[model samples]
Every structure is written in structure tokens, then in C-alpha cells.
Target: MNQATRNVLCMTGIKKSFSGVPALWGVDFELRPGEIHALVGENGAGKSTLIKIMTGAYRRDSGVIEYDQKSVAFLNPTEAQAAGIVAVYQEIQLVDFRTVAENIFLGREPHRFGIIDRRVMNTRAADILERLGLQIDPRSVVGSLNIAHRQMVAIARAISFGARVLILDEPTSSLTETEVSVLFNVMRRLKSEGTSIVYVSHRFEELYAVCDRVTVLRDGRNIVTRSLSTLNRLELVCYMLGRQPEEVSKGVTAFREQSQNILDRPVLLQAEALKYKKRLDGVSIEMRHGEIVGLAGLLGSGRSETVRALFGAEPLESGTVKLEGSLLSLRDPHDAIAAGIAFLSEDRKADGIIPELSVRENLTLAALPNLTQWGIVSRKQQNELVERFMRRLDIKAASAEQKIHELSGGNQQKVLLARWLCKNTKLLLLDEPTRGIDVGAKREIQQLIAELAEQGLGVVMISSEVEELVEGSQRVIVLRDGQSIAELSGEQKNIKTILHAMAEGADRQEAVGK
Candidate 1:
């Protein structure tokens, strides 16, 4: 809140380019001594690039970094950490085989007379965990812990370095509401101790709740830096999206008469009392043919978990999934795919595409078994199928042989769509499919979802973009804490209605309670 105080970290004219494409263009950023500064923008807005440069993961083409009023250049992450800078990324990179204590003190383990001190490290880990208000056994394997616990471990590791400036990138993306509150409490404690924090997240509600000031970037350029008190949620979104909230064109939301007819169709996929460990809890939902079902929930509301369960990526401990009047047991992704179900994950870079493979190869990956002739792939047949869907979906690619990583996010998403379509899939589980793509591509994908449903393909789509969810889905299934809370169908399917269902879980509880 004190504008007169000197900045703890400041970067001026920070510029970076990837493959000759400019990612950050003369960006300016500043972090005060003890304030939570948020970096927000739509995907490809240079937030990650800026963080990478600051954390020594990427060298800036041109920039001046001033930390504690001394110009510094970090040669590597080690050097950055040595200089009291640590970044806790959204996608946590930790060795699962290692124990929590080992991960917390990785690369900087305590040693006594040439012997690694496990007892000392575990004691330190316990102390750090206590500071964060997290309760976990230090000797527990990292893989055994849930996503939220893993994130806390990452935070503890960052704080263990005694870093003055900490970067938290989408820290609450995979965490439950309770876990998020714990994280916020940790941030407050850190801020109180004069530790500057850089918070990056897409969820705007969190910005006002936790951050002190926010910096908006758009198309690799810094747009504005404003205090949280100076901006509202809509204004902040408008800034990050590079458009006026009122100027951005909204899609047609009016439901047609034929939309109601979709409900009368056969129940395509149904789950009863779907329960998965920490992620999903007693969730149940049903979808019908010619229906685009929207999974609506806040961050960590088990929206994606529910879809993952349906797609068979995450096994359900206790539940029955019936597809088209057939009781199905899907243990893995292949099983779900064989049952004519396809999943488009939220984290496209990690789960959706194979960067080393060509667009055609990625598209035909799931359908390869069918395309093979006597254990040999028919290139001619593969090319034909790829070309057909590429053309049909209007996927802009230099050629089918082009590497998927080389294409834009939108094109890559289209290629992913082609993957499922090529498989002759009947049900599509889309988790944040439009996320990180451009506006034009977002609209195209939305239209494609509608078109696919019109052709009688069942869709269960999850999106943080409320407008997209409301417009793309005919029926909305709202989840709260991995449980189905409300089903908005027929004339009640709208953004307002879906938000109500998502925000108020008690509507379903009231009915059951009665």
C-alpha cells in the first residue's frame, strides 16, 4: 500500500523472443517489499516468459533487472535461488519417488561430516510444513500425496531457500477451496514477514481476494498496473483480455425450441455415485445424445475430476459408468477410447499433444490401431484420414507433417479435435478445451462443439470461460467438491443459471434433504 517504498524487485525493458517470435516486448514489472503482486493476462501474454527470464530459466534478449537496488544476472536456476529468488510453478516439477523431506531440501540437503542427515532434513521439513499450516509426514513419498499437498511441498521448498521474492504461478488451479484458503493464509503470513510475492493466476476472483496490486499484459505487452482497490473483476478481465468488457462481442445465448428435444433422447452416458479419492466424492451425472453438457464449477470444484473419471483417466473407486445401456468398466484411457469416448485434457502442453510428433501423427495417435494393416501402419490411409479431418475442421497447418509444437495453440487444439473425430468417437470429454487459445479459434471451437452435438455426438465440456460454457452446452452439470450439485436443463440453461448452480450447491442438497 506504500507507493513511496522502494521496490524489492524491478525489471525494465525486459524483452524475450522464442524462435524469432517476440514473446515479451519491453515489459516493465515491479514487486514491492511485502505485497502480493499479480501478473494476469490471457494465454501467450508473456507472463510465463517474464517469470522464466526472472527465474533464469530463459535469458532475456534485452533487459535490466534490479533486485534490492543492485543489478544482477542469473546464469541458472541455482544462481537465482542463491540470490533469494524462487518460483513455484503451476505444473509442479518434483521427483515422485522422493520423500516430502527429500523434495523440500532437494539439491541443498543437510550433511554432517560427509554423511546425509535424514533426521535433520525431516525435522526441518516438519518445521517448514508447520509454518505453512500444512500437516503431512515428511517421510511420505511425494507421489502418494494429493495435488494440493504436492503444491504445498513446492511452496515449502521455495520458502526453504529463504527467498526474499517468491513467484507462485497458478498455485490454486488444482487445489480445493479449503486448500486455497490455506495457501492464502500462507501468503498473508509471508507478506507480513516482508517477503514480496508474485502471484499468477487466471481465476480473477482470487486476485481480489489475495493480491495487493495487479499488472495486466496483453499480446506480449504490458497494458496497465493497478492496485486491487482501483479495479473491479470485470475491469481487470477487460484489461487482461485487451478489450472493453462491453465491447467484446457475446455469442448467441437464446435457446431454440429444438434444444428441449435433446433431453428426450437416449441417455448416452450415466454415472451413479461416482467416487474417486480426494478428487471426486460421490459425483453422479448423466448425458444424452445430441446434447452438449457443461460441467460448471469453480476452481477445484471437481469439474475436471468428474470429466477425468468419465474419460477413464482417473479410476473411480466406487461407481458404475453405463454407456448406451451397457455397463462399462474402463480402467485406462485406451479402454475409454475403445468404448468410443475421447478426452481432451485441460493442460494441452502436458497431456494433449506429442510435441515431437507431427500434427498428423498426433491426430491419428488414438486411431492408429484401426489404421494399421497386419501390424503395419498404412501411411496413405493415415494421410487420407488426416487430410479429411484437417479440411473439415479448418485446421490451419503448413502440412500434416508439421510438428504439433510448431503450430499455434488454436491449430494444435483443432488437431486434438481431429484426433477424437478420426476415432469415430460418440462421446467427447472436453476439459477447458478453449483455454489459452485465441478469440477467433475459441469461437470456431464453440461452433464445432455445437455442430458435433447436432450430428448426435454426446459432449461433456468443462471451461472456466463462463460464456463459452453457457453458449456451448445445452445442459449444465454443476459440481461442488467433486459432487454433482445441480443440473440446469431445458429453458434454465444460461450463464446466470449455471453460475447459480455452481455457486449454490445447496439447491441439490435441499431437494435431497427434503
Candidate 2:
């Protein structure tokens, strides 16, 4: 491959459908040698779906994929790996119990006389970590490392596989600024070696900094693919959204109050100076009726951990939560739910849904006690609640009895939403509720959150989409290094101001520590 003029990978007219719903339609894309290409779109713009098709996770319905001028059909992930296609997905996929070296060499460990060679694997892992400028013990268990370190390990593993085409899906979602810089340096090094990298992220600043070309997708279709030098952030956002830059402002006013009896009510949920382990410092936030509180920050800023602390998933060492002027007991998830608080975890497959269960079963799993009388579940009540939420959340499935594993990612997310809705919650903590869903489903979920707030159910939302956070939140709380530094609300809440506060707070905190 020539750095000046060589196409490393190309896909034309790619089409994929699942259960009558199309995820990718007539998609065309290309990656150039020694170039960093960014694929941008809102949630469910077929970004992940397109990558999965290219990497052999899903077979395209009709399309042609050419790598190195050779058309190929990858049968599985292993086949794609053999073809030098590697991906580090947004969601963590590494085994937690394994050490970093073991994870790097998994399924392909060097052997001596048919015996696994741990020493060689450890040496190679150490060398790779050093090349990446990461300081960590290769023998250390991945479970013990923070999310940021785990992400780096994933990247290292991919690079060690001798991947020629690297697909990084939201790679920096959980990284600090320093770690992100380190990753960028690694990407440049790979590019220098004639590797073609595909970068997918929602952060416009990052896209501008690292990508050489940009491709935008909307509603499962490719919108544009152009040189990064040809477009600004505003133009790129507009293209990804299928709207003009000026037209984007019109949608902001559509978020009107949709329900009643929400404004005059007292605080439904409140967290005061909450601290949790190493992830969260002193964080304080509150939720009021008819209002959604958004948590915004870079990855590792403790945004997700703050919600976990409030929901009792992460034990709070020092903090207090009050509901309606009385302190609430949150010893565990059960206690939190009993106190009228519901939490939707960020990891949907591991923490939110049970793969083997039916959609209705999963939805009613949490509130079974209430749906039962004298230790006997009332089937009628369970069905009623499930049907109600299914309609409310717009969960499209073959039936309520459909296996959750069989549905699309958007439908699965809707099922999880219904799980909390089945419980009569006064306060809801939603962590990336729109993640891994289609654009239509993402919009539906956002609208539902607004509607819930209007109905007097307080909401605490954590999202990667800054635009969503800015538009949906009545108050925005900025967290960094596990501490709440600023709150933007009422007349002061805007995207630019919230981002400025986060940056300023991080700088101040770092200076104070020095």
C-alpha cells in the first residue's frame, strides 16, 4: 500500500436487514492507507452496524467489501482477524478475571512443545505497553484496573494482532485527556506504518483533532464522506444530523412541557456531597419534579459512578440522599427500589437484561413482588403492566413473549426502559439510555424522558451525546475526578457554558492538587 495513493478498504452498496428491519441500506465507504477516517452519526446511525458487517459480526444482505483490492466475505470474527481486520468496540469485551498479558495473547498464545508460553507472552505484552507509553503491570488482572486502563489494554491487544485496518469504536469514551493523547500518538505511529484507521466518536473536537477524513451517516444511510479539511465542526454536525447548521437550532424549542403537576412538587431525589471509592470525589446533585438533571464530563470524570452511588450499586463512603425532605435508605438496589428510586445501568447486556428471558419476563423481573399477592404472582397484573410500558416505550417485538436476545439493540434498550417503568418510580437514574439504539429509537427514548419529567417523575440522565444532554437537561451538573465542580441551570444552562465549566474545573482541581 502506498501512503500517497492506495485504497486499503472499500465497501459499496452494503445492505443488511434483521427481522424485516434494515440496519444498513446502500451504504458506501472507503478507508485510505495511512489515513485516519472518522465515522460520525447520532445513536443508531448504522455506525456500529456497518462496522460489524465489515468485521464479520453480521453478514451483509447485499454488498461488496474489498480489502486490498480483493473482495472477501468474512464468515466470523476469527476470519476477519485472519484478514487483518481488528476492532476495539465501545462496550468492553475483555474477560475481567484474566491478566493483561493473558488477554492480549488469548486464543493465540505462543507455545513451546504444545505447552502455553507465559513468559514470552508477558515479554511481548510488556513491549507493546511500553510502545504505547502505558505504565502498568502486564501480569495485573484486568478486573483490578480502572475503565481507562482496560480500554488501553483492548487497544494494545488489537495492535499486537498485527491489524492493518484498525476500527476503534468510541475508543476515548472513558479516557482522560492525557490517556486520549497517548492513544492519538499510538494511532499516528500506526499510520506511519501504513495502517488504515477508522475512528468513530461523538466528540467533534476529537474528530477534528485526529481524523483526516470524515463520513457521516443518518438513518442507516451514508450522508457524506469528505476530507476533514473541507468541513468545520458545525458543518459536520449538520451533515450527521441530516439538517442544516441553522436548522439544528429550530429543534431546541420543541422541548416544551408535555405533562402537568410537575413544577410545584418538592425535590423527589437529592444527593449531597456524595463520595464513592476512587471513582467519585465529593459530588452533589439534585432532581426535582418536571425536570431532568444531566451529568456531563469526559470519560473517567466519575459521571457514571455518581449515578451508581445514588442507586447503591456503588457504596457511598460519605454522602446523604433525601427524598421529599426525608433521608432515604439505600443500602442496596432492593432498598433503593423500595424507596421509589430506579436505576438503568450502563451495561445493558451484563447488568440490565437477561438473555434467556422473555421480554415481558425481563420487564417485570424487578417489580415482581408488587405484581404478586401473598407470594403468588398475579399473571393478569404482570401482563397489564408489561403491555402498558411496551406501548409507552414503543418497544417493537414479535410479541411480549419474544426472547430479549432476538430483538434489535434498540428494542432491547426499550425493554430495559420498561423494566424500570414497570416499577412505580418517583426518581429514575438513566445511564446512557439511548446507547446502541437506532436514531428513531434514540429520539423516542429522549422524548419519553422529557415526558416522564413532565409527569413529575424526577430524572437523572447520563449520556455521551452532549447535544442531548444540553437539550434535555433542566440542570446540568459537571463532574471531574469524582467531584462536582459546577452546576448550570435555569438561564445559565447551555452546551458551551457547561463545557467551559468542566474544563475550568478540571484545570483548577489539577492546580490545587499541585
Candidate 3:
């Protein structure tokens, strides 16, 4: 390429290995000036390895990297930052003991006579926050701010570095819908100022919303690079998975094929007006056996809180839950488990997986008491149970002894699902079951959910995607401002119908909910 049309950042023949195992095999990536480039693939697709190499976290075994018409080798992140390249990671890396202003100008504080200029630093920090449309105070302590604010602060800190090229890894993982819009605005503003951004995220919608171009990686090799507007969602998924559109697109709504007669079926769970602080004002749910009931709502509308209340994780002020004609506890999670209730939380890394434990250990963790006989556990029985679920779920792990953290996001999620299936659980609450997984793994997990429900397991699922709720659930309960405002089923169980209730409140035109 000529100098006039040369890529602002280019890496050719990039190769890296960990312990002699290939991570990136001759990966080629190019970033044009003033563009939002998306780097995406399934877990273990070497996306992170490439980004780390760019930021000097991991040295490439062999490669050529050109930045701004000059070949450069950065030995550390400090050098990379000095060269006007900064990365804001998924996990916020900042001192919680300091203020937002202090964290933003941590090393390069504007100084008068070499002394720290607190006034000038705070003013500059405030200006940066204003530019990003953040309402946060510059003097606010980082520890006291909420996760969304902390994430914004991390972005602001990166912006303060005068970055010519910025990398954002899962930046919206902790953000709300409105916050995500603000972040996108900031990104667009930076792009207009001739800053190249490399966005790494598993969320496809976000890529379609803001990304200009995308590069797909698979099995440590570059698969395809194309303008996102040229490829549809199904086509993009196909490239990332190396599958034909017909093969991967089948059975997307296969669960709806099974007939569900909710009126005649026995009720597995009957939650009566559950109240949890302000989040759940009075949400009620009725899930029948051999059926999947969906909870639909916007953020803070109590979709998750209702499930948590049913699982006994959220202590309700006043509510009653019945499981098979017996009153289930509304205070203790252990009691809920003993009563044959299983809950898979939305944030798997935070509430679900025991990262340091082995696959076998994590699988059998909740069932340990049952597996133990007279205060002593049988290793043979535990191993058999673990092996059975692993095979059933098709979890891709090296061995039963492999650490849970080493597994991919999809496999870890499957292991968590297996954790409950190993028990004699009757009612399963899955919150965002397929979030952050690849198309192939997501399809597998969705198929598994359908199979489990077909086997007579009562399921109550919550998904942010309207399509998933309409297709997977027999009926949907739409919540708004902590109340179950509408119930949709039969001919009314489409994406538009459900979204209307969740967003527009049905305007008293629809019949009252059950």
C-alpha cells in the first residue's frame, strides 16, 4: 500500500505461542485511520492474545507491526502508552483508594513548578468527563462510585492519554443501555478526531450498531475481514464458526415446535406478588411442568429480581412461593435448593462459577451433601455423576481435573448448567443463559435447554433478546417498573407483542395478565 493509503496500524504475519501451543498463527490485521474496527471470535480464537501483543503484554514469536508509518516494538504497556496507544480492559484497573481525578491523571498530572497541581488536574478531569457526557464528579472516590460510573471513569482515563489508537475490550459489559449510548458517542467523537479504535466484544448487536469493519478469527487464524454493513448477522456468525448459513441457522426456534398446553399442565411454581425492596414491587409468576415460561423486561424492571426472589437469593419483604403444592422458602438459597430449585445467575463469573475449582469439583459442588454418606463422600459415586453430566452436556474440557477457569466461556456455562442437572432439581431458573457465547456454543446451549424442558423439567428463563423469549418460552410475562404488567401467549406471543408490553405498557388495550 502507498503511504497515502497505508493503514494507520498494520500487523502482517503475526504469530504467537504459549507453551509451544499456537495462539495466533500468521494473523494479519489492519486498522484504518478514524475507523471503529471490531475484533471478534469465539473464546480461544486468539482475539485476546493479539490485543495483548499489541499492548506489549505478550511478545509475538514472529511478526511485523507498523504504527503510523513506522515499525515499532513496545516491550511494555508503558512504552505503548507513551507511543499514544492505550487499552481499557474489561476489568477496571485503577486505584479504588483514589479520586476520579487522581486516577485519570495518575502519572501525568499537570504540574506548576514540578509540584502536583490539584486544581488544574481536577479541572482537566472534569472537562474530560463532560466531553463523554458523564455526570460523575471528578472528586468522587472511585470506590464509592457504582460499576457503570467506574467503567466510564476507566474510559475517561484512557481518553486522557491523547491516544492516537485506543483499544476497548468488553467496554459495555457493566454498562446500561443509556451508558452504552454515551460510550458510543464518545467513540464516534474520537473517530472523527482521527483516532483508530479496536473494539473486542462478544456482543454481535454492538458490532452491528457502531463498528465500521470486522475481522473474524478462528482456531488461531484469520478467517475473514469485511465491512460489517456488507454481512448480515447469520453470515457473520457463519464466518466465525466456519459453518454454512443453512447448517447453523436451522433449529433457531425449534423449541416452539413442541406443543405446550399450559392450562391443563400442572403448575410447578406459583409465586404470589413477590416484593423485594423497590426492584420488585409485586411480581408474580406461574410456571407449569414440561414448559418454559419467560420473563421479559428492560433493565431494573425486576426480571432478574423475580428469579432471585424465587431462588431465595433475594430476601422478599412479603411473598409466597409454592413448588409442587409445598411452600418454598423465601429467605434461604439452600432451602430453595433442597426443595429442588436450581438457579443460574446472569453474571456467571461473579455468582455462578468457582473459578479455582476443578471441573469435577464445580459440577458436584451443590450436590455434595447428597453425595456424602454419613459425613463421608464416596469418590467413586462422585466421579460417576460428574462423568455422566459432562458427557450429557458435551462440555469441552481437557479432563475432569481441569480447572474451571481454563475452560472457555461456553464450556464454563455448560458446566454450571450441569451443576444443577446433577441434582434432583425440578425447577430451573436460567437468567441470560446464552449471553457472551459464540453462535455455535449458543446454539448448543439453546438446544440443551429445549431438551431439558422436553424431559419434563420446568424452566423459567429471562432473556434480553425478544426473539429468544418469543421462540423459546411457551408464554411471556412482561414486567415494567417492578410489576408484571402483561402476559402474552397464543397468537399474541411474537416479538412485537411482547416488546409492546415491555415498552409501551399495552395501554389497557390487552386483557389483564394471569
Clash totals, every prediction: 0, 1, 0
lDDT leader: 3
lDDT of all the models against the reference?
Answer: 0.83, 0.81, 0.84
lDDT of 1 at 281: 80
Best candidate (score: TM-score): 1
**Could you report the Cα RMSD, in angstroms, for every candidate shown?**
5.9, 7.1, 7.7
RMSD of 3: 7.7
TM-score of 2: 0.66
Poorly placed runs, candidate 1 (over 4 Å): 1-4, 38-47, 88-162, 169-189, 200-211, 215-258, 272-283, 296-304, 345-365, 371-373, 376-419, 422-424, 431-448, 463-467, 478-492, 495-514
lDDT of 2 by residue, 210-234 (tens): 8999998888999999998888654
lDDT of 3 by residue, 1-514 (tens): 6843668889989999889989999999999999999998865689999998898888999999999888988999888888888999988998999999999999888899989999999999999999877889999999999877898888889889888889999888667678788889888888998989999876666888899999999889999999999987656655665655233232454354656565687888889988876577778888788888899866556888888888888899997899998887666898888899999998898999989999999999988987899999888999999999999999999999999999988999999999999889899999999987888888888889989988889999998766678788888998876788888888777654665465456464264233
Q: Residue-wise lDDT of candidate 1 within 1-514, one digit each (tens)?
A: 4423589898999988889989999999999899899998765688889998899998989989988888888988899998999999889999999999999999899999999899999999999999877888999999999998899899899999998999999888678888889889989988998999999976656878999999988879999999989886546645654444244334543222236587578999888999887568888878899888888776567888888888888888998999998998889887888899999998899998999999999999988998998899999999999989999999998899999999999899999999999887989999888888887887788778878888899988887666666567777787776778787665566554554455445453344323
Model 3, position 502, has a per-residue lDDT of 54
Per-model TM-score, in order, reads: 0.72, 0.66, 0.63
| Candidate 2, lDDT over the whole model | 0.81
Clashing pairs in 3: none
